[model samples]
Target: MRLIAGVDIGNSTTEVCIGEIDNLGNVTFPASASCPTTGTKGTVVNVHGIKSALKEAMAKIGKDVSDISLIRLNEAAPVIGDTAMETLTETVITDSSMIGHNPSTPAGAGQAVGKLIGFQNLGSARQNEPYILVVPARYSYEDIASVVNRINGMINIEGIILQADEAVLVYNRLDKKIPVIDEVKQIDKVPDGEIAAIEVALEGQGVRMLSNPYGIATLLNLDAEQTRKVTPIAKSLVGKRSAVVIKTPAGNVKENVLPAGEIYLSGEKDISVNLDEGAEKIMKTVADAGKINDITGQSGTNVGNMFERIKTGMSDLGTVEKSDIHITDILAVDTLAPVKISGALAGETCLEKAVGVAAMVKTHHLPMEKIAESLRQDLGTDVVVAGVEAIMAGLGAVTTPGTKLPLAILDMGGGSTDAAIINENGEISMVHQAGAGELVSMLIQTELGLEDRHMAEQIKRYPLAKVESLFHMRLENGQMTFVEDSIDPRFYGRVVLLSENGLIRMEKDIPMEKIVQVRRDAKRKVFVTNAFRALKTVAPDGNLKNVSNVVLVGGSAEDFEIPEMLLEEFANYRIVCGRGNIRGCEGPRNAVATGLVLSYVGEMK
Candidate 1:
């Protein structure tokens, strides 16, 4: 009797499977285990996670590490996923044309249009026209109301805009009922004599007029071309509870092109392409470059730092020469990055157009031999480095109950989307594409403006819910779930992470609907896009129609929606796609580990 342990180290997880080989060379596996990868795969640190997983598996069967006959560790690839999704695009703000941003609390109702004037000058303004009061934060509501009520007898005071949170107090104490907008931190920046429009919606609702391009055009009396130009401004102001728009001179709205810089693809002949043409054109150039020698970015630019970081990190690894690292694939998604407004009435952000690039670099050498030698010395057990990861995954996937060859396996793991096709003759053709689960998490973090990485990770792992009331909450799908006790006041009327530890408030000021949209859109961009990209490479004639079956197997495969998303995307080609079932019990895990044991048997042949 012999007990063999097959361990597979991944970008995000490490798994193990223990099997017993009989006298007839038949293997019966009884235990399997998994844990988070301790560190970068193929490094000395990974031995910790591998041993931890093996220990867990051994504990299941009441056995110790010494009972294991042999340990098989995977030959991990050199490339780690760089989840940088940054882009560059340009937009110029003409004067103080618009203020579009979220303010924690806003008060008032309806819209007001008036000639802006200094609050102190209200005493001297013409009584013939309506005027909007601009109250600075220095003055209390008592003084503001005292001045405003006294002026109402002289002129038609339409509405009030305050730089402090006294809207309700002033509105309640006033002799007249008018819309009030507060928290205008830059109240002094409002041009003294410019015509402006202010809109404040009722509680739980958002401003509509200023967010509409036509509404701004109508208020400013601008022509068609000018209205079209301010569309971005209106679009950015969409969910604000209140907004202010002012018009400036024609040239005030500047036009500047965002310089995303250029990339140099080193091949037989190095060719450079501007990143503004987007990832499609850049990748087409890379495809034409046979045997990518290297890739470099322009100096003193975002792309420059990205490439430099990858090179420096690879250099720090001390295994692969920095010069030998080649970019194998790139995925670019057009996205908007939020940038702070320089000076504005409310805390404002301009959505700048950017290209989020996820790049995969390939190295000429495999760094697994060093890891295997180190593991052997540390564990007091013989360790063998297996062949290519995709090949092992495909072999393991064949163990699925109803699997047969000429089949393609979509090994959707964090850091990389690997695909492998096993022909009828048992030959394997495989490739890896960058952008996976971690990339999805990066997108969620950036789009939602979350600085906490752990919060973003939790959002990626769990479904979101909005705490509508104390007793019940509505989930992302609009299903209502009831809790016996009232939710924490901080999470009330807010989107929350429904984690195992209870509800965690999403600190961002975005709504539940928007958060759900960002998360789903991100998953679609990474998984749906990479699925087609990965399958096209291994399928005959580079067509997805040729591949009949796709079994998803990886840490991400267990996701509630990813498999469904891939299935929907692959439905067009009539390909049968589903998550892999390894050993009929390990849903999408243990495939690579199970295959390692089978591959060791193959080596004996």
Candidate 2:
């Protein structure tokens, strides 16, 4: 008997499957294991992870690495996926600035228009002119209230801007109440002697006057052109609880269309589409290109920089030159990315329209040859680069119980979603498309404004809950569960991920329902959309309805909800869809590894 191992290096992990072939060319799986991928997939650095996983798998069956006679490595797809947020719109404060943010408890309700005067300058203010007090954090709430009250009627104090979190305390102490906007981190940025308008919405509501361009114009006595210029500033304050817009002599807030740049597609016909035209047009242009031979971006633009970065990184890792690394496919998704507005008094961010793109770069020569040779040198075993990943995955997918020939498989990995079909006659067809789990995580991170990538990946993988009490928590499905132990106080009243290691609290104050919505929406946008796009490309006659049974295999296929989502979607087309159980033992993983061994045994036969 000859023992062989199959190692599949994926975007996130490396999987290994060990099998023994008898004299009759029969093969039986013995063990399997996985570990985090050491570096980018299909690179020489993957040899470390490949060896680690091989040892782990051998140990599972009480064997040593020397016992394995041969190692089969899946010809890892050369496609490299990279995601970037291309902001189409940017808020630029030219000569003026604004502070529009949601403070926890902004005091008072109503709009106030006055000249922005420092607390010290309040003493020298003109009695006839209305002035807004910009108080520094050095003053106590009592001191600020006392000073504002002392000059309330005498100096016409109309509003208050506090540097500290004392809006409620100061507003309550004032004899004459006025709109109070607090938590101004950059309080010093507020220009002195500029006309300013402050608005505080009623409890549980957003600011009105400041959120409207016409309202800002009416308050600041702006002309038609000036009102048009401040529209972006008004848009930035739409959902704010409290806001302050200041009018300097030459100050203006302008929303500029960023030079996101254009993408050139080379195929049957060279086509170019500008990024400012949005995702739909870009995708349409991509589709019209028939088969994308290569893709390039406009010089000196966001997309240009993005492609250059991707190519440079790939060239650095593999034998391919930067010029030879061509982007084979791209998935452009419309998104609202939270981008910081430039020159804003507060560190405020606006939901700018953006296109989140995932590009796949493919090279003429397979990059896996180097990886296989490196592993052979280290392990001192005959390492052979096996069949294409999708083809091999299909061979293993058919091993699923109740599956037969003419079956289709969707292998949704971190870097790409690959679809393949194995017909009864043993003919195989496959297509690889950009965007998958990584893109989904990117969307979740950007939409939720999360800085922690681990949190985003965990959120994408697990369900969420809200810690209502020490004992009970409400799940995303609105079901409540009580635990015996007291939950951590840190998770109290916060949205948390129900991970295998217990509840992980999210630092952001986003609501449980919104988090759930965003999580599911991101999945739908990437996986579901890519499912249709990929299936159409590989299905018989390029039609999904013509396809029958589809077995999902890969890390993402094990997602808690993605399989069900695909099930619901494919139901309309009468396609049998579910996650694959590789060899009736492995669930939605090790398909490519298992397929590698199976293909080798077939060659032996």
Candidate 3:
């Protein structure tokens, strides 16, 4: 009988699974175990932690390490991806210089020359005088009507240039029709005392008299050279990026080209790009072309370098050489600082940075020696990588299929939140975030002034209960029990121990109520918020609307309220939330190891 083991090394904990594959290709998971992850993830810190988890899992299956024939490990990409989400929380006003307005159709033939004034400012004495009408975005059609009605007889209201949609509304409201452009983003940028032309075209209608640069100049009684000046403004507002444009009626518009190129790199090394080309040129460059580096001196996300790192490490270890190792098949999800691109026309674009989780082996026939070598080099440590064939075989297990074409597995471990997305097309994306259970523990330790990370972790993991009297006590699980004998007075009204030790008091007289409140709030802020943010970033459009289900696994997911809280936050998207059943017993916590094993089987096939 051939047995395989899967081990997932996470930031807070390491999970192990053991499985057996029969001659018919059916896999059975017999046992699973979880222990705190040793050392920093992606960095070789503690091998003992991982070894202990392996031993515990092996013992559960009633087998020793020698019984295992082969092992599979997930590709340990050294880079960690970090992500942050911030919405427009406040609105601030700035000095108006640019306007973006859209007017689908406008009336009149050419440029209208006149003094600009607000709709309300027009009066009777200006009836024959040429004028430009200005509209504010906030005002409704009704509001514009009231102002126009009051000054109807006093001003000519000769030419109407309003906000994008307002043009149509104002046109319908007028007794006599005039040239109007509706969608205008910037009404504040309209130059005062300038000869501006408004271009309008109806459905199936070409440019009118106002459409020609010279025609507008004729209408405004300007010389040919002067008319050329206004033409530029009229055309500027017509394209995709332009929201609005106000120019001299005679100015002409011209288009210019910018040359560019793109550079792609692979590996964890940092790189720098020299800005030999112009900013616009850089923006136009395509992906995976030209020279690039692993580590970029400029701050930004680098996927190419991440890919290179994983590949180099794997290649050196002979994983790709001895077996069919496919690096491109494994999606690299980065959760890192947003890369700040300096020479792009779009301004500072945030490039996705974190390269956290990766799936290396596929097919069961791949050689293990090469796999181990690759893992050691890439992970930068002496590695013992293993894969289990099945996650539920020995235990009383129920197999539940998952919904959602692209499913995300979130390993909410202690030190970090590891996430991976497996699309229906078999494409996998993964990322590792730095802050996780450890961050929560730090918060609790700092808030309550506790010096111990272990104590803080326990407090963050469990709930609190106060011991009211000697005869009765409360538990963190919300259950109450009675004691036969009188307990110590110090334990009364203090946090009660749920362990076999009975009631015990906390050190230094810390209040149970304060401890509970602080722990709960801290966990919610760190874990829940980070989970949602991570999921959204990995989602197709960075929106949860497309994601309906989130599979949560890890030591942190064991918390009773954590999953429920996630369900509530993602309820709007109709998401079904639950844990992964590794070996039919360990929920959602052993997916990486299980996946690692499954990846091995695919390699053999």
Candidate 4:
């Protein structure tokens, strides 16, 4: 009899399976253990998690890591999920600058070119100048409107800016129709005597003049240089219903680009493509190039620096050189990044469209080899690199109750999704693609325009609900439920992330239904699309119909709704799909580890 152990060091987890095989080739798994991955997959830092898991699995049978006759580790691919998406929009402010934010319920839709003036100081204000009166909270709507009407002939009052919610009321009483922007929380901050351009869109429309840099230039009579300088602020306010732009004092808005350099794809011949063209173009070039041996980024570009940094980091590890590192596969997603508007008050930001890239680098399997040698020296046990991760994971999935050959498994992990199948004849085929859990999280963060990644992660993991009342909450599916006690006041009137811990308040002002839709849509877009793509590639004849069953395994498999989503999608093709049950106990996890043990005994079918 021999005792063997399998350790699968994954992107986000480290799994271990321990078993004994008798002379007859029968296998019995006595214990298994798993821990969070400590560092990058396929790196030396993973030894911490591997050691911890190995000790735990060995302890289950009253044995230690030293007692194991041999150890097997999966050949984990080097896939890195890069969240460095850059936003293209920024705020630019020149002299007399104004920042625009959406204010609910403005009155009298029309564009007005004017000079902003203080309401009280209008007595000293110059005549023949187009005037936009700024009203404070201390004055009543009735009194202010009456005063403006009385002074109508003497002053050219084209627009009104108010601190209170009285834009409609004041507009109704005015004899001369004028645009009014009300509910300005900081009305006192509007500088007087500045060249102001106020635009209130017609109901159901958006402001045009203030949103366009050229329009602002036309209204403010700014030169070409000034218009170029003000473009960022205009871009920042592009979609608002109403906006106000003022020429402020000499604060410059420099639109800086993070150089995500060119991608060098090696195919029929080597060709370089710009990363700024986005992922679609880059991947298309890669496809056209035929088989891509490796990809690297341009020097000083964002992506270029990213690749260089990865090489520099690995080189710092002193185990691998830069040349041995090869980017085997890459995944990119369209996303948004927030850039603060220059001279923006109240921390205004614009969500700029960007591409989030995740690359899977092949490191000549030296990282795994180093790990094997280290373990052998430390534990006095023989160690070997089993094989590719996807094939091993398929071997592990067989340990699931009632699973058989001629089926496929989708390993939806954090960095990449792996699909593999084991035929009845014992042949195995596999493929790995970029995009999975972290990509979904990136999509959520971009769509929701959130600043905090921790919140974005929670949003990805949980369902959404609106804390409508203190004692009742409206679920994402439009169902309402009552609580025994009143909900927290902080969560009231806010879209919340319903995580395992509790309700997490979202700072962004979005409806719960919208938030829920974006979250689910992002998952469906990444996982469901990848699910079919994976199945079709690995299935017989490259058709999904050829495969009968698919088992999902990985951290993403644990999501509350991803499995259901994939099931519904697969149902259309007459294929059955469900989360894997490794060893009939470990749910959607440790499949590769168990497969290692089976492969060791040569009992794998």
Say which candidate scores most in TM-score. 2
| Candidates 1 and 4, the one with greater TM-score | 1
Off by over 4 Å in 3: 42-47, 77-404, 475-479, 485-490, 497-504
TM-score of each: 0.84, 0.94, 0.48, 0.77
* Residue lDDT tens for model 4, 1-605: 88888998887889999988887889998999999888777777788898999998888789878888889999886555433454332233344456576777899998897888888898887778789899998999999899999998888998998888888999999999999988878876788887788889888878888888899988889888888877777887787777788777564444554655677877577888876787667666765675567878877666777667656665665546767767666666566667666566556776766666656655554478888887788778899998777778888888788778887999999878889888998788888776788888878887788786778889888888888899998888888989998898988888887777888888878777777877888788778867876677678888888898899999899899999999998898888789999988989988889888888777443
RMSD of 1: 4.1
Poorest 10 consecutive residues by lDDT, candidate 4? 83-92
Error of 4 at 533 (Å): 4.5
Per-residue lDDT of candidate 2, residues 398-499 (tens digit)? 889999889999999998999888899989888889999999899999988889778899989889888899999998898999999999898888888888
Count of clashing pairs, candidate 4? 15
Clashes of each: 3, 0, 85, 15
lDDT of 4: 0.80
What is candidate 1's lDDT per residue for 252-368, written digit by digit as tens? 445554456888878876788887887567667765764556678897766777678867776676556777777666666666677655334455666676667677777655567
- TM-score of predicted structure 4: 0.77
Clashing pairs in 2: none
Candidate 4 — which residues are off by over 4 angstroms? 1-5, 18-33, 51-72, 78-98, 103-113, 117-124, 127-192, 199-242, 247-262, 268-282, 297-324, 336-353, 369-388, 532-545, 568-573, 600-605
Which portions of model 1 miss their true places by more than 4 Å?
A: 91-94, 101-143, 150-159, 185-197, 201-235, 245-257, 262-274, 279-293, 297-322, 345-347, 364-366, 484-490
In terms of lDDT, model 1 sits at 0.79
